[model samples]
Target: MREDTKYALITGASGDIGREIAIALAKQGFHLYLHYNRNEKAIALLQEELVLFGVDVIPIQADFTNSDAISRLQDSVFQLDVFVHAAGNSYYGLFQDMPDQEIANLWDIHVHFPMQLLQKWIPKLQRSDAGRIIFISSIWGEVGAAMEVAYSAVKGAQIAFCKALAQEIAASGTTVNVVSPGMVDTKMNHLFDEEEKTALLTDIPMHRFAKPSEVGEVVAFLASDRASYMTGQTMRLDGGWFMR
Candidate 1:
């Protein structure tokens, strides 16, 4: 690693949106710490592709559902400039039908574990000249989704956390923000059938779901020095759907 190489730790780097974020950062010459729970093959493939960008790509695995894994993840990272929280799962069911264990799993994966990891990594971020903390939240976090109540709650929590943390660390030159994308065209949205997707399109003025690369580009900008002055703000990438 070069002395001036910037390191970015992206959780869920094997997933669709996460993979794009990793690629965007790599294109900007960032050494990547790609974190994944399972899908070793996906991470391996992504690692192979990222190396062409001439940046070091290190893969780290940790099940976020298990809090004890946080320590291991922290130990794996040496230096950090950006931390992107993109690891999450969405539950599609009525809030009442959701199981206690599933709710706990969502909370642990989306909020609790990430918070603990940040607690450990914040110091390293502060040491850097410009540090960025970004959360890949959802449009549902801004406008509640009926069946995804729990998912919306956790994402909303992420937004609140970002705003508060940005305030706490702004003096240190670290910026925290949320990228709440609406109806991203990823495998995650495959749960919606054709009819459902069509209906969703009608709501979005752009009449289309956002591409993963679009999300990645916005994230890349946030992680860059250009976004240094922008913190505690939510970048709504929802194509005019549920605009606030």
Candidate 2:
């Protein structure tokens, strides 16, 4: 890694949104630590794509839900200019049928892991001339979802966490914010059939699902110096889904 080159450590980098964010960051000459729990092949392919930019790209695997893994991550990455916590899991079921373990997993990934990473990297990130911490939340986190009760709870807490942490780190030159997306066209929502997709799309004022690359570009700008004054903000990338 070049001594002067800055780095962004993005969790869930194997997913569609994560992969696009990696490309966007690479285009801006940011070295990347693309973290994934599984999908070795996808990470390998992403590495091949990223190499075209001639930046340092390190693909790492760590289950963010595990406390031990979180500790190891803190040890490995001492400094990060951009920290994007995109690692998340979702369970779509009624609150009555939701098992205890599934509920725990939601909080582990969405709430605990993000705050843990932010806490661990506080000193290092503050040392940077400019640093940004972004949490990938969902519109469900904003208004709360019916079947996605656990997911919405955890994600909602993350939004609150971002606001509080943003204030704490403001004087230290670090920004903390959340990006709440709605109905992104990713594998996560592949389980939805054409009819279900159509129903969901109709609710969005834009009448379409968000492309992964669009979210990526938004993240890149938020992480850049151009957004220096933005902090503690829940920037809604939803296409007016919550409007209706």
Candidate 3:
């Protein structure tokens, strides 16, 4: 709570990628508001681990699909210098066969809730000397995936949202950007079998999937003062895949 301390809120802090982001920020002396929907035990353990970095870590729980999630989140944190939207899930299946409820959940979790929360937090972010807003989007957002049609759609929406929001808020000294990662080695990608993963490796010029920590490192850099001039940009962390 020191006046000189920097604070960051990272949603989905329990996930592998989220955990890495939390660790990276903690190492940089950022007091964290670690948000998670479920997995209390996971987040609690993460909090313990982060304390070693000498930053205050507060865990907040809210189901992004719930209508009142925005209120719950807004009430939990009083100060924020950075907000990272890392909370998301992918629906893998034919777009036509995807259920109405699943699509709604995807939109609510990835887009609706985060947008509303940012709306509430913008004023606070503007007060900071260097505020940051980062979205952990997917490479599939830039290039659509076959079975993940709905997921691709939501991720793409995130990219567009950051681009527009960045322009609107640049004058306030706050930057908005997207980190679109490709084929990260996490539980989300664990849905694919070993053979499937091998095939995916062949597609990536790096011949391997991204580690969660690699994504975290990029996010930490973006949250730092070094990224002051950067805004409304989507940094593709796709390992030479889907270059644009």
Model-by-model lDDT, in order?
Answer: 0.93, 0.89, 0.93
Candidate with more favorable, higher TM-score: 2 or 3? 3
Q: Considering only N, C-alpha and C atoms within 3 Å, which residue pairs clash in candidate 1? A: none
lDDT of 2 by residue, 131-238 (tens): 889999999999998999989999899999999999988998799988999989999999889998989988889999999998899899999999999999998888
The alpha-carbon lDDT assigned to residue 100 of candidate 1 equals 99
TM-score of 2: 0.97
Clashes of 3: 0
Order the numbered candidates by lDDT, best leading: 3, 1, 2
Backbone atom clashes (below 3 Å) for every candidate: 0, 0, 0
lDDT of 1 at 158: 94
* Candidate 3 structure quality by residue, lDDT tens digits, 100-150: 999999999999999999988999899889899999999988989999998
Give the TM-score of each candidate: 0.98, 0.97, 0.98
Model 2: CA > 4 A from native: 1-3
Give per-residue CA lDDT, model 1, range 173-192, as digits (tens).
99999999999989988999
Q: Which is the better candidate, 1 or 2, if ranked by TM-score?
A: 1
Kindly give the stretch of ten consecutive residues in candidate 2 with the minimal lDDT sum: 235-244
